[model samples]
Target: MKPQLLPRKSPRQARSKALVTAILDATAQVLVERGYAGSSTNLIASRAGVSIGSVYQYFPNKDSLIAALRERHATDLYDTLDAVLTRRNPQSLEEKLSAIVHGWMLAHQLEPDLHRVVEQEFPFFERAHQDQIPIYRTIVERVRQLLEEHREQLLPDNLDLATWMVLQTIESLIHAATTTTPLPVHQPAAIEQQIVEMLTRYLQVVNPR
Candidate 1:
């Protein structure tokens, strides 16, 4: 059977929530500094200043802790996407694209080291679309709504395919820009502008005056 990745139980009270948060925070730190091989439940417990038993109280093993961290990270990304996609004021397609690209990059930058570790050390962390990976689908559907709202300005007849391509392009490029080194331009605004322009041109977005 596959290793148990889910937590043993969810934290209920305030103290329990705090304990769980500490464990997850420590897990992120260890994963970033030590990579997967070196990150053990013992090490994570020590980092969190908790006992091994306390760590195992919620998580069965390192895999479970990692899985929880992945969920937390996905939630953070979803929150960022929601912030842009659910704006009260209306925005042009290019404006929305810029907001999402910038917001997504900012969210990743908030934990760049941990992000790199998650993506590199545990490749499965980002394998979305299955029932286990609902965040990817959630994000895709949110973008689809945005596209539907601007259907008149959009060029693609198939919104689903266009949404997939748009997300792939942004995600692939942003991951490359953040994870890889020695990029030609390091200014985030410049990179975001380029991404927005690329998407806008691809979508054939026409903003009416």
Candidate 2:
């Protein structure tokens, strides 16, 4: 078990809220324009037009700031997943999976470089904010149910392992697609189809076990 990196407190008032928003917005630009090494509190404050003290008021350190950014990203992705779950197509697992995949895809596309920086440059950030990762458990649970419901269409046993693979496959591929340099062509429709096709086929037992 690890402690979650977090801000000192959340913004409550309208003015303070605006300041936090500006700070985070500026943080994103700094992260994009400058790598993690260059994204210092002074630089972020200067970019945000707020005093460096204001930054410290909300975030204790650079790591905390980065963690908050990661938290924001996680929230967006989870919200997208929640929205997809609300109207998931019951008859078509592909449609349901596609919605989840595309929702997360859009979330990553919101800040690709920052996402890369969080994942590649400071992988520890993920560990620091491990608290937020469980939001994704809903996806895995839903997937497990899908596996059980379609047991005849899928393998008899190992539904748990299959579910993990399906979740990881979508997550890893999309993360690579968004973060890799000399990035692969991101034809949304084609990518979605390929993901759905691969996942569907993998779950489908051609030779029954």
Candidate 3:
């Protein structure tokens, strides 16, 4: 149909903004209930109590609408990480790692249904969301910087590689634990502790030299 990328035009007024919000929320609901393919713009408009024209005003097709949902979720994750990174570190890096574990877990758990549906309906690890690479890379770089600051605590190797590895470890596990059927780890607290231990040992300052 149409190239489903950016919105046709951003909402400028309060009423239009609210309508867009409703449309997005409706789309999320539809995705959860009917999965990705069933989340059509017409169906979303109906659930949003709006006209098909209104949905088309913002999103050209289901692809654009789903992209919006994907961006929204990514924003939530970055915002959560920002909150932790902005705070003063009054605790050990291990404790901060634990906070991050908790933050990501809670963030995904915030929309478990949507998350599961997205995983099932979209090829997130593939080309569909390739446009989001820079967004993810920026976050990875932020984490890399954080790790570099604690270079003394990490193995004296390529810090960039180490940060990337750590990120993949955490992301892969979180994705599995949250979206997979019969989760890879069911005990939330235990899993959190395990991750903390894993990262803690991996990044500990062994030699000051």
Better of 2 and 3 by lDDT: 2
Question: In angstroms, what RMSD does candidate 3 have relative to the true structure?
Answer: 3.0
Per-residue lDDT of candidate 1, residues 58-172 (tens digit)? 9998988888887787678889867765673447777788878977886777787787787778744445623375675787888888899899888898999999889889877
Give candidate 3's total backbone clashes.
Answer: 0
Task: Name the weakest run of 10 consecutive residues (lDDT summed) in model 1.
Answer: 122-131
Q: What's the true lDDT of residue 142 in model 3?
A: 72
**Pairing residues by index, what is the TM-score of model 2?**
0.80
**lDDT per model, in order?**
0.81, 0.76, 0.75
Instruction: List RMSD in Å for every model shown.
Output: 2.6, 3.5, 3.0
Best by TM-score: 1
Ranking by TM-score: 1, 3, 2
**Residue ranges of candidate 2 with Cα displaced over 4 Å:** 1-4, 84-90, 126-134, 137-153, 156-160, 181-186, 205-209
Of models 1 and 3, which has the larger lDDT? 1
- Candidate number that wins on TM-score, 1 or 2: 1
Relative to the unseen true structure, what is the C-alpha lDDT of residue 82 in candidate 2, on a scale of 0 to 100? 70
Best-performing candidate as measured by lDDT? 1
* Per-structure clash totals for the candidates: 0, 0, 0
